[model samples]
Target: MSRVRNGLIGRGLIPVWLLLPIVALFAVGYVLPLSQLVLKSLQSEGSWSLKSYLEIAHSPTFFWIVLRTLTLAATVTLICLLVAYPLAYMIARCSPRVASLMLLVVTLPYLTSVLIRTYGWIVLLGPSGPINKTLLQLGVISEPLQMVFNAAGVYIGMVQVQLPLMVFPLYAALARVNPSLTKAAQSLGSPPTDAFLRVTLPASMPGLVSGCTLVFLSCLGFYITPELLGGPDDYLIAQGISLRVLILGNFSDAAAQSSLLLLAVIMIFLVFRRRIAEELDDSSRFDDISPLGATASGLAARRPIVERASLLSHHVGLRIHEALTSVRRPLLRFFAGLALLLLTLPFAVVIPLAFSDAPYLTFPPPGYSLRWFSRLFSNTQWLDALSFSLRWAGLSALLSVAVGVPAAFALVRHRFPGRLAIYLLLISPLIVPHVVMAVSLFFALAGTSLIGSPLAFALGYAIIGAPYAVVVTIAGLKRFDRTLERAATSLGANQITILRTVTLPLLLPTLASAAIFAFIVGFDDVVFGLFLSGPNATPLPMRMWDNIRLEISPQIAVVAVMFLAVLAILGLLRLFVGAAIEGRRSQAKT
Candidate 1:
């Protein structure tokens, strides 16, 4: 038996037991559910039909909504790219310490929940909110502008939330620009501005394109932001799907919309497949020849008309070049600072409004009080939602880690046929947008009696959360030493005993990190809550989503502030506490 086991191990198949559990979970959690959804979508009146798809295709409302969603996503992508370019340039050129600090500011949007960040935008952009109040006091307008609950609010909120996604990628691209190219350009009598335009800018296109593709897809899938901030007239595709399912009970219609939307995403992804790889790859090698880019660079590097005329004209051109170069660096830093300030403003606005003693959401509080927070704690409805959200998050985290760790181990250690297929199946929940997942799971589980239960929420979230844990566990496993496991196997220990005594203990910290990530994802989720939650089983984010639409209150502001504070604590723990522990262990080892 030992010889057979060793032979299998030598063939890179010893750690294969975990593969079955992962495949089974993926089948139940994703493949079977989504397959049923696709089958239902193709059937109508107990017969296979394209009626739903045809109806949606011919409907003007569907066309208008989808077009609007695409337009918003493109606009947001452009805004993010334009804003992040200078910011990324400045950061890339800064000292490492300064860049790290600034990067933290850029990361604020990602740290807080999307639901919380969107709420912050509401308090800042509403008619009676800070932007309106400032404009009113400044006499910029005769009356307060209705910014929230409209298209403008949706645009602003989407851009703000998605900007960080753009910046970090562009910065990574810029940081990798070879300084020697710029130096060579300068050595050839080019000004700093000319050097950057000719050399540095073109090299960063990969990162910019990657960021734009990512932000476009992410914005196209907007759920809670547009719902909370957009007017009745400003529905996006995701919002429309939810309304069809929850309001009209039109699962067939919703499924058709989801299928179309998924197709659109797939097409977009196929178009930019190379650019999207920048998310994981070290650097994008832009060896593709672009006649347009080459022409533009040649044009920009060409001298002004006057400079081609005379010596005096050339002297004046040199002065102009010096002047632009002189101000360019400072200008880049200033605007970059302003853009980063906008990233922090959403959460900054939440703190004062949360403590406001005012009857409604107000900034620069007339007086400070804990009234809203007290109300947050005392309300039984809120208390119940909080309890349910926490329990579901915990259980979902456990499920995610249990499912993901095995999957990661099997993939890392095995050399089996159909390996890539299983990997893709496990990670499909992440690739498929949240709207599709929610709609498909809602209809599939609604076939059973699980739709309105907390268990439904956990299962749905676990399916999504598993991908995060899997990615993190895979990273940790790549750093793990296989020799230790082999040594244990040779010491008369079975595979399970080796994993218990050696593998699990070694990867314990990584598993904890995966659990924490799963917890955050499950807790912050609003889509599953939107589709599957009952009134009695509402999660905290769902409560926030409801209050924004049905009841306007300062209490929501309190919750947003709480989210900020709790996330800050977690960030601190992840940074400082983890570092301290690792430091102590290093010292002990030494």
Candidate 2:
């Protein structure tokens, strides 16, 4: 026990010493407001009662809201799965170069803020927008479609935003499949369709399940897209809970709604547990990769004319992969051309539009100028909000990493009691909608000094962000060999020195990944920002919310574009860095 303690002390296992500013900041911002939230919820009108919970249970509107939220979440998940599966499967089966390009195209949208990305859908789906204009020009419609502020708009935005979540897991799962298994089945006299059905599909089920779980989990907590795109009557549980707490100040009712929503989501996860577990298992029969006496080329050559035509109908996918990967520069150029049109155009439009002189949105503005950009800077409210956001993000990111690194190490290196439970608790923030958490927090911390402070807000946001850091960091740690640390120790290095020279260097990539994730979580946050932030602590997202609600300001668009650009740059950097590290590791193995 003494040696263990001494070893830990020597290794820098001691917790980080919180700076005076951070401690003061957290106390005022997080701890105080949270306490107030709980006190307010429980001691309403000077008496503690179950009346608030009972009132929420009795409300018909709450039940309907809950149902609508779940329905929207489930629908979005279904759509993401349907669209993402084929894309994921194609990418997985393609050559490495092609697969990488396809994955990049699919995930690029994920780099943008949800608000900005959802706004793109708003423009596309709005009445008299391009879609309507195009249809009219083609003589296919007599009038502009009423697409925005409807379920259709909601579906479009949600599916587009969540598609990557579905695609990523499915792609990972599909990539793990042994290519030869399908070929072997085909050689045993099964038809190609039957071979894939009986072999490839079942083998890739884990990725499909993981993707579905992730998408479904994320969809349940979606606030921005649905709130922006859907009609007021189309309130989901998140919107409902947000209204109850931030707008209506009905803390108890919001808590009850949140508790129920959490329960429902947990139940859904429980139902899908076995499938998800099977998917996560590394020892499963899915990872074998040696090919059976066939290749994709061989399969294509033997296909009958009818089968060929059917395959030809799907030939665009093959061509895309080929174009993306082929040694011929022309083929690669063809793929790049398509990406420019479909993926890059929307992003390009926003950057120039931020400099528009015209008041209204247009493709080629009436003589572009830096009017909005200047206006964005001159706005004191926005400037204050921007400063607040930066400070909160920087502080929250630091604190989250501080807590997250140790927890990740503990999770990766040691087995302890209730480990799984601790994991679930840590990641629960990921599954539970932020609005619901905000509500529970409002109830949980009522009457404390933490309510309405920046620290309280950051604390809540940090909790949400920490799980992502831990999960990513643990993935890095798992890939890391402990042998290097042991070797360093044997060569006369102490624990701290070994960690500094060995573990930290090895885990730096994951650490950066975690930091980026933490920043993104803080940056895109709205639900907690809405509930927790006060005038002094208002972040950029909250400020945007205020601007949108108060007036039709083009400066909001400028803010949105700048924010998106920063996030995109950061995301690209992270991606390249991660890829580089992965490449280095692979080379070392070879």
Say what the RMSD of model 1 is: 5.3
Give TM per candidate: 0.85, 0.80
Best by TM-score: 1
Candidate that scores best on lDDT: 1
Candidate 1, residues 1-590: lDDT per residue as tens digits? Answer: 99998986765654456766666766777777777777877878889999898898789989999989989999989998888888888888889999988888887677578877787888888778888888989999989888888999998888888898899779877886767767877998988876676667677767777788778888887788888889989989998888888899888888888888877776777677656533222222443324344335433554434434524676766777789998997788788988887788887777777888988765778999999988899999998898898899989999999978988877776557766556655655655779888888887787677879888888888888898888779878876767767877777899779888877866767887788788888998989887888866799887877887777677877887777777678677766655765675455346
What's the distance in Å from true for residue 249, model 1? 1.6
Model 2's alpha-carbon lDDT is 0.68
- Which run of 10 residues does model 2 get worst, by summed lDDT? 13-22
In the predicted model 1, the residue pairs found to clash are: none
